[model samples]
Target chain A: MSNATNLDGAITLITGAGRGIGFGIAEVLSERGSVIAISDLDADAAGTASDAINSTGGQAAAFQGDTTSQDSMDALAAAVLQEFGHIDILVCNAGVIGAPGYQDRTEHTEADWDATFGVNVKGLVHTTNSVTPHMCERNTGRVVNIASQAGRKPRGARIALGSVQSPYTVSKAAVIQWTHLLAVELAPHNITVNAVCPGVLWTPMWETIAENQKANNPELSELTSREIFDLSINERMPMGREQTPRDIGKAVAFLASDDASEITGQALNVNGGAVMN
Target chain B: MPESSLGQLAGKVALVTGGARGIGLGIATVLVERGATVALCDLAQTACDKAVSDLGAAGHSVLGTVADVTSRDSMESAVANVNTTLGGIDILVANAGVWASEGYENRPEYNDADWDITHSVNVRGVVNATEAVIPYMKEHKRGKIVNIASHGGRKPRGTATGRTLGMPYSVSKAGVIQWTHLLAVELAPFNINVNAVCPGELWTSMIEGIFTNRQNLVGGGSGGSVRNEYDEFMQTTVPLGRGQTPRDIGKAVAFLASDDAAEITGQALNVNGGARMN
Candidate 1:
């Protein structure tokens, strides 16, 4: 609403906030003046993160909640309301890769699909649904869903051989479409819903992918993390370097802020220059 | 594409459809000013010749050709002559388009011929031109294609009849929207970048004609006047409280067609005055 960058007094919630992309988002959101509530399945890790935020003079609390459970989702919302009064931004960043080697079509199982979707797709919905009513009443809110470039551009050496087929891709694609639908539905209420499609960053997901590739082919030596990320935009990723989680965090913060009020139903790519659209 | 022109487009050649006027002419004018051998193509030979001669007289290497965008043979010949005369094609601006039924007076019984012509010139013509030059681009391993769409393709035009004269125009523009993505994906392998620009209302001759024709066909209705209707739409709908200019659209097209947009393929960018952020 204002040109100022101060996000002071904003109430923000991030799912799967223990580490990796979720933690990256939390750190940036807190730095920009938001009082954050970090939700994670691992209560201990979340506590440590909350403590870190507190030590840095940012208001934050940890909620040990399983995203797959409706009871946990409602409880997280209740706790946040009791602590912060209202929620202004919802970051649907929780996700899981399931077990290793699950991407191999021949080795995949229904359990892998259900597990990935339960935490990635259903989890996002549960968290977002928790914040909608409060945001609707306020007539001001921002919802940022973190998707992957893989969801839009299905390209990988293993994908060609049906080796990388997995529920992760399906779940992420669902997230992107879900963002699009919510954007229109919430337009009348002055709420903006957007998704960010980030390519391979130096995150835990990249490590998982690299390890999976090595496990699938013992003869194939693991490439450097930079090498893996460099391949995101056919190595022409315009930012001219591998992506750091900070790049994704900066974009998430920008979208969640008032500066992006006019932007909605759009999927902004923060993949260094990969996936420009 | 050719040794990175160092921003010349200098040694390269370019062509823009609908180049006789409006946004197309704006882009053609910029390209020529930048030192690229440019060509102007339009449905009317007289108009095309006039534009070419005018630009040529100003010390620019420019050509004018009468061609139907929807015609494959015409596009092939136009592209061939540019190649023969300038040696190669570097940039292609597919900016020609027509938008009738602006005020939705002919909602139910709108001219079928008008719809057919819009689709032919706006959508199919783009495909024909792109497909024609893609082969040579693949061989050369680089190219840039800019397709002009509209913000109307994304939002609905609300009117009392609820017709809004949008179905045909929006449908055709939507096709261009999807075509940008399809072409981007297909040409990325060949080092070619394909992008689309969705312009908001602009002060162009074509827009003036639409307003004048709307007033001639239908009275101001409940509104005060045609000018009043235009003012209300611009001030109320757009956040910036203003409209775009041909030069504004030109700057956006130039960005997408340049190396700055090298990694920006499959993108449908809005050059609206903050009307539609996506």
Candidate 2:
């Protein structure tokens, strides 16, 4: 059994903790008594999110960092470590959806693929590199990478877009595989690494996806984004319900807890059963 | 309705096939603990009665049924019994399964019997249970069907069972996973959610039996106890370096059965302490 079981009073660092799922994770973790270090590319968003947590009676600090830049991540890591004394958990939730999957397009633009990969895949690596050293120094840590159900053999899952969001989906796939590789690498250090594949949360990313889907599909042009989202939910989601950010946050919190110390190199799906692979 | 979850399956009638012991019992116990009136359906009346008694002693609502998952008629009657006795079949945990290790020596040496039994019990059994409940669920317009799968169905483990090579059991589990997908899609309009839970490296009697047999046939006087063999495999393969409890599998089944997973369908969730992740 590991001595670190709970997230109570642990110092944590989260990438892209500005809003949506990232903020959702931060809030849940903070409620669990962890001091949060919120990082985002947008300084205002990061600060506002941190402040929101603080106002909610959770300890938090804000730092501006772009996950695509290793140097920037490294600096942000240093600042967070200095401010928080140590980083017991690192949540690499910063991600991009790339281009909205259009029904008519066979593939996405190169820039879309690169941008999606840059943030979703490589961004995770950069952030992991930034925080793992401090964790390695202490010989204990937890890493939860925010992945997507789309990344896990989701080709046949219509709710996740069969041919759409390829770049984003593929990049998330890479992130999951990378989580395994990193978990193996960090397991010896007592550092558990995992991924959380959220199902269908109506976050900003999903809004974009719904908008693009409706825009690209002639039949859906008359429908609203929320309506399109609902249609996908009703037709594809067996539960016929939308997933909440809190659902994903709860999963991340579990993986980060001591109870999940034995759970590593795994991707936990928080989707409402849309994609189960 | 989707707001309820985890510990809130109260009053829901849950039927667990092969629920006398092992993983099936594990799922039944959890569902019972969560306040569902559980019907334990197994092949032997004695085993089912004992299981039901043990659960009943704990002050939970539970019943027993002697039914074979491989037989559609038996399953249909069992489902009907559950419906009449417990009011309705709200959730069905298709936990009955068979693992064929009698064949596959080096590289999947498939035996005719192994293939037949595995498919008959693991794949077709799940389908039978699901089909038996579909009419009732469709009539009720609310249901959750969770099929038991294995990590072997998704990918080969790097060690242990992986060394046994891909065989009938793996293929049969693969079928269950696929069928879950199809059923999830087909049953969506009926407000029924279908999913699969793939457990990894649990040390159940079935697993203990596998290890003992494997040691006898493969190790040839390697002098390791079954538990020792299981521990060694967990150490080498599982990143978490641990074996999962049936309770762990139960938690997953309960989650998928609850409103918490209302949007989740056709998913194969792995509950094996990171032993297998694909």
Which candidate leads the pack in DockQ?
2
For each candidate, report its DockQ versus the true two-chain complex.
0.07, 0.29
lDDT score for candidate 2 against the true structure: 0.80
What DockQ does model 1 achieve?
0.07
What lDDT score is found at residue A171 in candidate 1? 81
The DockQ score of candidate 2 comes to 0.29
lDDT of 1 by residue, A82-187 (tens): 9889999898888877655553433556776888889888988888777888899998888999987766755434441243446777888888888777876776
The residue ranges of model 1 lying beyond 4 angstroms of the native Cα positions read A1-6, A99-107, A153-164, A222-240, B1-149, B152-266, B269-278
lDDT by residue (A38-88, candidate 2, tens digit) is 999999999999999999788999999999999999999999878978899
In the predicted model 2, the residue pairs found to clash are A5-A258, A199-A271, A239-B262, A272-B263, A272-B264, A273-B264, A273-B265, A276-B267, A276-B268
Docking category for candidate 2? Answer: acceptable
TM-score of chain A of 2: 0.93
